[model samples]
Structure formats: structure tokens, C-alpha cells
Target: MTPDDQPFRPISVFTDIAIEARDIVRGDAHQEIPGVRVEEHQARGVRVTEVEIFEESAERLMGKPRGHYITLDVPTFKERDPELRQRLTGMLTDQLKTVIPQDPQKSILVVGLGNWNATPDALGPRVVDRILVTRHLNQIVPEDLRDRMRAVAAVAPGVLGTTGIETLDMIRGIVDQTRPDVVVAIDALAARNLDRLLGSVQIADTGIHPGSGVGNRRQGLTETSLGVPVIAIGVCTVVQSISIAQEAVQLLVEELAEDVTLYKILREMTPAEQRGLVEEVLGSRFQDLMVTPKEIDVLIDDMADVLAEALNRALQPQLDRQEWT
Candidate 1:
């Protein structure tokens, strides 16, 4: 049996976070999915969920790779409260360390994978702007002065549209030359729920596919392609327009239920049927559209700063050890 009760919506399902996909899969598929493990905990007031898929069957069932996915859900992240900000950053730092190889000497190449020109898709570039780059610091700064920082490099490779070069190709070239032991990629992701946008971060060992969130497919940056371990950090920056419409329609139906005929019809339809009806009404033009929040301009910067701080803490082994102790 498939993870989901209904026939999976292929394109739409890909846009959801791995945890959301797991939630949908948990209904009636089985009491549990073999080779898949899920654990949840609270850290610094944030909900952290870790999903581990140990076998090919589990990987195929989840539509994610055979590795680990850690998600941090803190919807208030968009509000820009400084105290809350530090807490979430600390949580993200701890989760990031789990996926990264436990080697103090591992040099890291942080690849920011998104279009810098578009604010909604610019999480990668924005984080790179604030991240502490220390790969070149060894020659000039003394070890003690820099707190024994690891060699860390960062790059924001523009999308194929602007640079006319495949993102993977550019990163592969960098990896070949820099020879970093691991690559951490950051990108904007799309979620089915509006609340998750600008509020959730999903980190995975499966790397990432540029433009996949918006239904535009590109070659994925995975371990096999990059010849190194890859840890992808994704922040939900947009939500599918169709999902917004779906919620609106549901609310309208529920509010107008005194009229019964339409309410009964909707109640009789399956989720797939409801989504299909919404799609038909929305037509093909709006199918691929994704949306961001009204205050994205300010929130994006705040999010970038938080992610940069977390990356800094996670990438530096000396700092990571100090804090964990």
C-alpha cells in the first residue's frame, strides 16, 4: 500500500515539507512504515522533528531520500522578536550538527542555491550575505584570535536564468577545486500551509533541487552528483496559490453550511476530489503560482540573519562543542 490513502498528487506533494508528507502518509497506510523512524522533541520553545529513512522501501514510501530530515517549526519567527530569534537560532544550530559528519577537521563549502534577484526566492543569497566566511582567514588571522574556527567558504551561485550555467555545474567545479569535506546548501522552499511560510526550516542530508519548490525542475545537488556529503537547509518562503484557494473554499463552505445541499456535496467528496474541483475552478493559469507574505521585505532579512548565525555556530566545531557542553 502507498503511504497515502488516496492516489498521491505527484506535483503538488513535492512542494510540501517532508514532515507534512509524512503526516499525510500516516493515515491508514499502515500502523507504521517499515524502515522509517520519527522522533519529536522541544528545544528552546521550538518543535523539532527528526525523520530518518533507513531503507530504499522507506525512502520510496516517503518520496524523500534514504537519510534524515530535521524540521524546526516556530511560526513566530516572522515576528522578529530578538529573544525568540536567538532561541530558534540555537535550536537550528543543534539540529544542523546532527546531519553534518562528526569530524572536527572537516572543511565546509556553503552553497546558497537560489535566485538573488527575487526576494521571495532569495533566502539563500540573503543568508550568504550575513554568514561568517572564514575559509581564507587562516593566512591572515591567528588561530587563537579567531577562536580556532574551521575553514569555511560560501558562494551564492546565481540561477541558470541569470548566469547561464547550471547550479550543480558551478557548485561541482567549486567542490572539485576547494575539496571541502562537506557541502551545505541553503534554498527557499514552498509549503502547503501558509503558516509555515517564513516560519519553518527543514534541514536534510538529501541535498536540494533548485526551483523544485515552484514546480520547475532542475537537477538535484546530491551526494552522488557532488562527490561529497550534502546537507540542505530549506526555509519555507512561499506557499502554493492553490493551497490558499483550497483553504478559502473550505472556510466558505463551512460558514455557509446552513444551506446544506452544497455542504453535503463537499462532505461526500474525498480530498483528491476537492483538490481536483479547486484546480478546475482555478484553471491552468494559476496552477504554478506561489505567494509570499506582505512583509516579506523585512522578514526575509530577519530570517537571513537568524539562519546565518545558526550556520556560523553549526559550521564551527570549536563553537559547537563549547555551546553543547
Candidate 2:
């Protein structure tokens, strides 16, 4: 088919790594706009996908920013296998260490962004409760022990609905007061694919948009905005209803193309056209619905444990190793 035969497409609204990775996996060599680089790897059965949008142009195209985005896919994290859990934790700590500043003495602030009352949004708050907070302990600990341990502090700023305060504003105020060298923000994210929900963790140095996962985007917390390096860690806890319906229609079109005349007609249409048609039919019904797993409460607890363990180890590796050994 000629280039002109392609249908006009709407930009994707999903804020997950897999959507961007799809273009590369489909063998679309030119799909990557200039200034973007992607790399993939495997660590102990987990798939690690990394996408770097290096310039404003590429950032605009990806709808992210000029920083590194890393996604770790471990579909069986909820299974709670000891060995697998340990491996995943190790992988998470390794990735986090890469983005975090290397200064051993630098103070680090951990910001958990979410509403605790909602299970799907409680991942962050739960994680904060599990982190190894040493900032307060540093003052009373012996000099040698205190010197060896990094200063770490954590906070879970409740959502605007409860506090009537913008989450970013709270963080900014804390950042100004604490003067932390780096800020690590954790929150629940929304994925475009159901397979990604509850099975993936994303770490980025580009900062985070509170509530972006469920499409209620708020002001972003970033290095430029906060005057400190921000490292964001998130787990996909929900998927949009439109994405589910769109994928179902695509599957149906593929399955029936060989025999059904109508399916054959759809098969001849450009991908954009197919998606457009699907949206026209399903958009109104599915637009605002966000779907999560039936076992989200259990899954959120499991994820919070995993993420908290990883962050604890990453932020206090020296102390963590000493304790474990």
C-alpha cells in the first residue's frame, strides 16, 4: 500500500512503555522519530524495555520527555514465589540505583503519591510505610553508624480530594524545607493493555504527573519544576475501557478476515481507519471507564511489598546488605 493509502491516526493517550515499544516490535524501522532511542534486555526472566526521548521533538512525539524510561515486565509477580520475588527486587534496585545520584551522603526524599483509601491508588502510601526511613534516626545513631547510612525520608501526601491541596505543592514545600538532593516519587499508573496491569513496573528519571495513570493528570513533579532531580517509580494498576474494546475489535477483525466478507473489508483498511471505526462504535460507552483486576486489592498489597522492598534496598544498599548478611 502506498503512503497516501494510510489513514489519519489520533495520538495514543496511554502512558505506558509497551505502546511505544509496539512500533519497534512491529518492525517499523522509521517509526522512531529522531532523538529517540530504544533498547530491550532480559534480567532473570523479566523483560526490560528502555526508551529514551532525548530532545523536545522526540519528547513531543512520545508524549513523555527528555529522559530515560525503563519498564520491567514480570507477569508472575503476584504469584509470590520466593526466588522470583528476590530476583525482581534485585532487578528493581539495580534499575533504581542507575537513576539515583551516586553521592552516598546526599539526602534522599521519597514521595508516595496517591490516595490511601482506594486500593488501586494505595500502592504509594503502602510503599512509604514499608521504606527504611533513617533521616530521623541519623541524629541519635552513633557517628560511625550514622556516617555509613544514607539519610532517607519518606512522605505520602494524600490526594487533593481529601487534603484540598495540590500534591505537587506539598512536595515542593517539603523539597524547599528539606533540601533533598533527590526525590523519588512512587504512584499507581494506567496501562493501555490489560496484560500490563498489575504485572509491570516503570522507573523514569523524567519525573511524574500525579493521577496521569487514570487520566486525571495534575501538575507534574520534575527536576525543572521542583529544582531537584526526580526519579519516578510506578506500577500499572488499571487499563482504560476503550483500550480493552479496541483490542477486542482488532482481534475479531483478524480472526474473521479469512472467511467473513465484512472482516475482509476491514482487513483492507489502514490501521488508523480500523481503530477509528472501533472508537466510533465504542468510544462513548468506554471513554471514562478504567478497568482493574478483580483481585486488585490483593495485587496492590503484593506490589506495594515488592516496590517498598526494592526502594528500601536501593536507597540504603549499604545498610540493607549489612542487615541481610
Candidate 3:
């Protein structure tokens, strides 16, 4: 197909460190990423009202030392392709160099928090694939030894599938054995917008929940759970089926609004015809939304690299100072 006739590519917009509830709507309304639209009001007329839980819990959970949160908003999924992910990962490493404490002895627990079997919930495994694992690196001698000074481990506690084992149980087991100074949990998260897929990466000091992907709620990995700092890195990957339909409808409306002929045709068509058209446009393909799994693998791989770099930066200084004591 010619360039114009080709399918619309996914767009992304990356914002700086500042995150307010307001940016949520602004990002959508401004089309911060081209080609996609975010409708502010919902169909039932109930608007989204965000409650700031952080302000309330700051006093309760604020005392613990943990990694800082950084958000990178890419304008399009295509822009964050595999190659871009790799470059970004390196940039993230540089950025981390600037942020993390330079502690040579500091041991960190890099927790990959998702099941390996599921594609949508595979962020943990994908990230762990790119990290510098200490155990493996320790096997080599001095000259050939990789970066083995920093402590790192990958864990994916199967949700419910582990039978009666709780997430905390697994974390506690690891902490008891490894005694890492900090823990970083990477997992997939749910986003209200379908456009967020493979584009937005959120870094938070707060811990994460493992299988919240398909709506299975569980306790989170928190300082209280493990008596250690926890960092969460995630990208929102899934969109509700209804939300996909609504987005398709919104795109259709925008197209009809600009083209008078199309508008007239849509207006004249029966409800049944409109339903058929929408169904045809949105089928099983939409179900496997977000970028292709291959694309997601690229995104996750890059995301992991960026986070690893950031962690290295954050930890290296502290490590150098021999502060793990």
C-alpha cells in the first residue's frame, strides 16, 4: 500500500518528571501523540475523578528509603521500536548513573514480577532477560568477570498457581536468603487508555502487585511486606474490550465529522449497519491490541535495559562507598 493508504501508525508522547492528575487528561485532549484522540467525557456522562492517595499515605509510608519514580512518555509505539528501546535503554543507564548512589558493596534485588507463560503479563521475565545477573557473572575470574559486584536476582512468583503460597511468602524467602539492600519489581499494569500500550513506562518507589493484568486482585509488594525498599517499573498493556470498541467508534466519528459524505452515509445507515461496520473494523485483531508481541518484546527489552541502567546509576555510588553495611 502507498504511504497514505497504509494503516495509521501508533503515536506516543513522552513527558518530563512532573506528573499531576491533570497531565492525564491533558495528555489525551492535546493529542500529545498524533493520530490518537482521547475523549474527556464518558458515554454515561460520568467523568473520571482522581483521588490523590499519595498525599494521604505519605506520612504512613514516607519513611522508607526507596528509588525515585520517573516517567517516560513516548509519543508512539513505533517510535519505541526494538532499536529505539535499545538506545533508550542505554540512555536510561546513563540517567541512572546520574541518579543512583555509587555504592560498590550495595546489593540490590531486581525482582521480575510476572508469570513467564502469559504474553500480556510477561514484563518481569522480559526485563530479567536483559539484566546483569550477579550469580552468573560471579563464575568468571577477575579479568574476564562481568559486573558481578552489584547484586541482582530475577523472580517470578506464579500468581495463585503457586497454590497457597502468598506473594509475600516468596519475597520473604528471597530476602532471607539474598538480603538485598533494595528490591525492584517490574510487572505489567492496567491503563485506562488503550493508547498507553508499549509506550508509557512508569517508575515508582512503591511496590507492585503481580497478576493485576486480567483483573485478579492481590496484595502488593511493599516495604511492610519485606521490610526493604521496593521499586516498581511497569507499562500499561491491556485495554478492556469495551474500551477498544469505544475508541474505534471515536475514530469513526472523527472520520465522519471531517468527511461530509461519510458522515451522511453513517447517518443514513441503520443501527444494525453501523454495528456491522464497527464489528468488521474491530474483531479478534483488536483483542490482541497493543503492538504485536514481537513489538512488545522489543519494548519490554528496552524498558528493562533503561531500568537496569537507572538502578546501576542509583546504586553504584552507594556501592563504591561500601555502604551495604
Q: What is the C-alpha RMSD of each candidate to the true structure, in Å?
A: 3.4, 2.9, 12.2
| Residue 76 displacement (Å), model 2 | 3.0
Tens digits of per-residue lDDT, candidate 1, 1-325, equal 6645443332335564887766655543445567778999987889988888798766676667788888899988877789999899888888887777656568899999888889988989999887778787767886564656777899999999999999999999999999999999999998888889889999998888888867787899999999998999999999989889877777767777567788778866766577779989894877788889999988888889888988887777576444322
- Identify the leading candidate in terms of TM-score: 2
lDDT of 2 by residue, 1-325 (tens): 6755432222466655634434523332445556768799997988898877777755655567688889999888767677887788889989988888656698999999999999998999999998888888878988877867888889999999999999989999999998999999999998877778888999988899988656688999999999999999999998888888777767878899999998899888765566678779988788788998888898888888888888877787667465522
Those runs of model 1 whose alpha carbons end farther than 4 Å from true positions after fitting are 1-12, 26-30, 143-147, 258-260, 317-325
lDDT of candidate 3 over 212-325, digit per residue (tens): 544465777888888887767776665556345645665676667557776667766643355456657775455334333346666655555655555544554334323222
Q: How close is candidate 1 to the true structure, as a TM-score?
A: 0.89
Order the candidates by TM-score, highest first: 2, 1, 3
Report model 2's TM-score to 2 decimal places: 0.91
Worst 10 residues of 2 by lDDT: 19-28
Candidate 3 positional error at 255, Å: 3.1
Query: Between candidates 1 and 3, which one is better according to TM-score?
Result: 1
Q: Model 3, clash count? A: 29
Query: In order, how many clashes per candidate?
Result: 0, 0, 29
The model with the greater lDDT, 1 or 2, is 1
Clashes of 2: 0
Instruction: Give Cα-based local distance difference scores for all models.
Output: 0.81, 0.81, 0.54
**Per-model TM-score on C-alpha atoms:** 0.89, 0.91, 0.61
